[model samples]
Target chain A: MARLEETTADGRTLMRQTPASAEAQTANATLARKMRRRGEESRFWWLVPTIYIIFLMLPIYWLVNMSFKTNQEILGAFSLWPRNPTIANYMVIFTDPSWYKGYINSIIYVVMNTVISVTVALPAAYAFSRYRFLGDKHLFFWLLTNRMAPPAVFALPFFQLYSAFGLIDTHIAVALAHCLFNVPLAVWILEGFMSGVPKEIDETAYIDGYSFPRFFLRIFMPLIASGIGVACFFCFMFSWVELLIARTLTTTAAKPIAAIMTRTVSASGLDWGVLAAAGVLTILPGALVIWFVRNYIAKGFALGRV
Target chain B: MERTWNNKAWFMVLPVLLLVAFSAIIPLMTVVNYSVQDTFGNNDFFWAGSEWFDEILHSDRFWEAMGRNLVFSAIILIIEIPLGIFIALNMPKKGWGVPVCLVLMALPLLIPWNVVGTIWQVFGRVDIGLLGYSLRALGFNYNYVNDPFDAWITVIVMDVWHWTSLVVLLCYAGLVSIPDAYYQAAKIDGASRWAIFRYIQLPKMNRVLLIAVLLRFMDSFMIYTEPFVVTGGGPGNTTTFLSIDLVKLAIGEFNLGEAAAMSIVYFLIIMLLSWVFYTVMTAYDAEQ
Candidate 1:
């Protein structure tokens, strides 16, 4: 897959005089070439994938390996794989109300945030892609600026703002806080997808006497279904994995799994097994999400619209 | 067409504008307010008039944190971008290996930020963790908890492991977009490997590279969760970046004015850099 050659047309004159030296050099070159070609043809393909897989799997293997062992085992043993695997740690996380509720809270806010961001971003992206109005360029750039705003800087302001509005500890506050970044990203990605659709389609629909809403819903929406899926997936991923803003915005009722996980470590000691179990569980939803969206991620980027 | 151009199109965007304004503008105003005033509980406030800004601007602590953030971002970019591209180059463009490779690369990106920190925190212990235990068994003294250098290395390595995949995925998308004709052309021209990458692939990947660079820079600069989870910005503020320090000042210490000033400064820095990136990328795109 990665091969290159350099052409030297003028080398024919030099090649004629250096046949003796060239014959020996060519013999060695041919031998080296044969060896290299053999390497590529035989095991090179397998080697590439194997290295990548091992690189990717090591940390996850370590996490799962620790999760199966007892805390004492984790502290005392250094096994590559668990010797006597146990499910006691998994039970701790699944059975405990505090831990379980964290997952529920995380889902609630992430779904809410994703829904809000995608719904809002759809029209905005459409407008930016299709219309050239006053300040449209400026507005589009301004939206992207929000995506660049650091969540840490907004933490204090978000907390104070939510608290003042009596929205602290509510799922809405967390959802709203996430929109600061998610909505902008949704708009950007969706806008790219939307722009790729020819404007003549909209013009054709208008010539046929179709209204704006009807044209958008009937024609434009179906054309960009995959784009919407891609945008929603990104919105879900960012909102799902984010911690700093979610932690700052919620205290009790809406605490995400991330905040709950942080509490697992205490002055007494780290709960290695339970923590690993929680970590395992934390990755499950994202795994499922990426699986569902896996096909679209590459395809979406392949369009080169975003 | 003229009728479609009416202001009713503005209504299409109204929901987003309202949502963003409520979420972003209101809090921004609050930060602006706090940056210029002193608050002493029970809603009591006194006019400080840029004193907080002046203090933050002049403080060695702020400068140090800024320096650390810049260095961390630079290191992450240096490691991630090329490594990601190299990995992408090796990735399978066909067959079952494609999905397997992609899913594996995405595994780290799936884990929540704090959990990532926790994973490393446990994974780095000399007594209990595999990494620590194995390294110790192999005759290395590495202890991230106490050694400042180890702590920095641990944090940087952890981040690279987590985020480099994002760049890989982005670059892979760019790579796959190139037409087969380009490769055929290169082959016919007898182009050298370096020439192909320099003249063809690199130029084609520019758009995605721009996106990758900007996203990575912004995220690295704003990094808080992983380091906070692993080190708690500890061993005496060695890993304390601007975000961690802002949280400590605002929530931990309850110094609203100073925190607010710091946040504004933080926001400005991010905004300025992002604007520069956007302008440069867009201008380059236009030129192309």
Candidate 2:
């Protein structure tokens, strides 16, 4: 006899007969098993995520801790929190155009990349979802291969390519370069969501005198708006977090916050407090994004295709 | 699931093709061009004809970095995949623990990769940082800057902190898809705990686990930003991975030919490995 008590993820108890089993489970045994499971459930299962989350939060807490203290306090002594917390670190970022502009520069390019990637990816994703064009399968695979291409591999070439176009140190250069991976990702995700929509919707829209563009925008897009949102969130996330290609593609004018932070680490004496503050600020955009798409994140992390 | 054979569907794909060509193809072509030729000064090029590739293939530096990357990926995969599954299994099925776990766990994944490195670099500092200070007070000779072993541990821990959430989320997604009836059946059949897990939950999580493994391998193999920011490939090259070594060659030393050659090799290796993994996983999946 085999006990299947662990099959359900949440450890709920129920009984059914498998073909190979000779006899049904006894009610007494089932009751006993249920009691055991309830005991097991209450025996600190929540502590797993609780402890894991505490581990995850500690480093972030340290960063936040350092950000609030003065540089003197950071180096002078160690305290669990701050002995004297100040907004001076944040003030430095807000006041210094060089510091504040990094955030602006990062936002500008990230938004640009998200818009460009999603805009172009929409039609492409639609084609992949609905059509059997030449080399479609191969083309889809080829696009994904680009996502796996390391940013380091493209860094030098991207610099030269953008320099050739007189686009070096422009927001568009970073945005376009980031499209190398983001466009493919956007297409993959949007394609997954589009395929889930029934084909009859498209046929019905088209038959109702809805031209392709109008249908895609007005009728179809609204149907898969959440997919679009998920795609935009991912594109934004990747472009925002990525530093190598973005750092390589721009020098001063379009320098991202990441570049600025690195430059501070090298160019000036270390300003631990301000850097910590900048680090804390960078987490905000992504946190906000995840909060909005919290429900879709699991599916999004799976690229929405699963 | 039938798709129409409309030749005009090509028009819909045109934008992506053009954009990708502009971004990926042109730059890649430039790298290929540089790899095949030598340049001494401005506007001077002569056919090197795989000479750089030959040199890179024989160089210990290239091989050592590749070896480090492979080992690093292997170690992280071994640590992360099981840990992720364990955490996912213990996660709350419903209620506030759901959102709390999902959001907080996903936090590190959202942070800039560079910042993830910086967070560790500071957090591990012996002077002002909690982790380093605690280790010092506890009388350990823990210093990442001067110690190779410590550096590797810091990098690995940082990676776990940043990315284990991905595996957990993916596995949880897989776990939630399983119906309750299967558990009831297994219970009635008197299946053992290990037997139920081995036969049921593990099988259900197979697809996502495959994705998690493949993704974890690829990302960890290509890992550069976080480790670079943390260790700067320091402590006598103990931490230098392929990407950092390639960057140092290409940008730091201005060794374009070698770097470009190494780039092509690196790209090919990932493709081959990923292809192998994909085929193996899909075959295993089909059998079950």
Candidate 3:
């Protein structure tokens, strides 16, 4: 599918070189002029994204705005920016062991899940891209169905399953449960990237007496470095954002930040400031992750790995 | 790409196979076991063949939740896909604008899903939220907690705000991959902007768009946390989708047999729908 554009573009180039008539040169000039005018007129297109970004930012801005204010400022009036700004709301999360532990637990499992998902998915993705195994297509689709699965279906059973193993209330339980979806996602994305690499690289490495693992780590992996980055980002994104399975798998010891927020909301009255502050804090890790891999996400997904 | 038939590749796949089996197959077996049988307060069981499934299929509550899930998914897809494409098209092709727009756009996707619900939940409160307060000031009766229509609209808008970026990012990826030569050729042929989009950009974007659609469809269909947080499927059960209802049945009421059967049906519906989407899109892809 990707080759379609390149082939047609090649054909157009060849035709461009062989002009038809004297009138064609004049036609080209006029077309160029029209294109320039179109470009100028399309400047208004920037406003579209500008408006969208503003919309996306509004709720977040409200969250952040509420985070800095105390309960008095929040209930006192509806303000765009907090008038009496204070950090006491953030202090509650930072100082409290129970609250801060949620962030720690969330990060621990998300990292563990990303590491586990990518490590296992790497070899499988290579296998799918390089060789046609028996039932490979069926296997691939089955793996993806796991990604599409509703967490609710798995939640109760997952609780029972993990409990039987005495894995409940542990970080690893949450991490492994997340892999039910993240592994499939990592495999799908990595396979797309691996397929884009030329097979000759594999052949050449083998001829050079490189072992399979050695070749994968030294040669093949480097070629798809951006792909690996993209896969990791997705794995992290899904595992971090997901709550249902994570919530069911753990009650207190490994409760994710999300579950903690829900618990706090229910147990105590609504502390909009603290909740909003906690929300902003939860957003930071993801924002930082995105910032570091921002370029890779843009460029790598252009391979249409999705 | 050509591949030699290598049975040993199964070794590479074995790790994932085992992991998923332990995580997916075992739990699925448990659910299956529950669906086919009866259970009392204790672990007592009786032989009941498809009894729970029968009840679930016959229930209006089940069908209504299923219908709500369908409508919700359809609404989000209809809005997100086109809006994402439009924004992606307008996004700058190069320089500083690229990363700036991408980072800001991606912010929502990275936040925890429940927080997304909370952000909107608080943002739409008639008392304190900006959107709700502004609407009230303009003389519109806006209260999501009381009005079912308002609840649904709030949920839809929150979803649109949160997820449209994903569509934008995916479409932008495809748009960027389109070589400038195609655009140049279209210009040489005096093609209209719409023609260039239809013939060039749209086809190149087909794969990414397929992924976007599948992901959005699957996620929206199974939506639980966001809507559950925003509306609690409430004002009544007006906003309750399958996942929300299944959670309530399975966890809240602890009706294991009925919930297990409903979960199976819920899962099968998504699986069947996704399979259809995968086939139809790939078939179209093969044609191109």
Task: Specify the highest-DockQ model's number.
Answer: 3
Expressed as tens digits, the lDDT of each residue in A10-122 for candidate 2 is: 43343343323534345544654563474245678889999999999999999999999998899887899998889999999999999899999999999999999999999
DockQ of each: 0.41, 0.56, 0.57
> What digit string (tens of lDDT, one per residue) describes model 3 on residues A1-306?
224433432343443555678587557556655764564356587899899999999999999999999888898877899898899999999999999999999999999999999999999998998899899988987887888899999999999999999999999999999999989888977887788788998999999999998999999888888778888998888899999999998988999899999887878747889999999999998888798777556433333254
Tens digits of per-residue lDDT, candidate 1, A57-129, equal 6778889998899988877767888899999999998899998999999999999999999999999888877
Choose 1 or 2, whichever is better by DockQ.
2
- Per-residue lDDT tens digits for candidate 2, residues B1-288, read 579998798898999999999998998899999899999889699999999999999999999999999999998999999999999988887688798888999999999999999999999999988999999999999999999999999999999999999999999878866765566567768777777679988989988888888889999999999999989998889999999999999899989999999999998887787576656654784676
Question: Once superposed on the true structure, which residue ranges of model 2 sit more than 4 Å away at CA?
Answer: A1-42, B277-288
Whichever of 1 and 3 has more DockQ, that candidate is: 3
Candidate 3 accuracy as lDDT: 0.86
Instruction: Give the per-residue lDDT of model 1 (tens digit) for B1-288.
Output: 121344555787889889999889999999999999987688899999989999999999999988998999999999999988877766665568777778878878878888888888877878877777888989999999899888999899889889888888887777766644455456557666667678877887788888788879988999999999888887688899988998999889988899999999999888898788778877986787
Ranking by TM-score: 3, 2, 1
After superposition, which runs of candidate 1 have C-alpha atoms over 4 Å from their true positions? Answer: A1-49, A298-306, B1-7
CAPRI tier for the interface of model 3 = medium
For all predicted structures, in order, the TM-scores are: 0.90, 0.93, 0.93
Which docking class does model 1 fall in?
Answer: acceptable
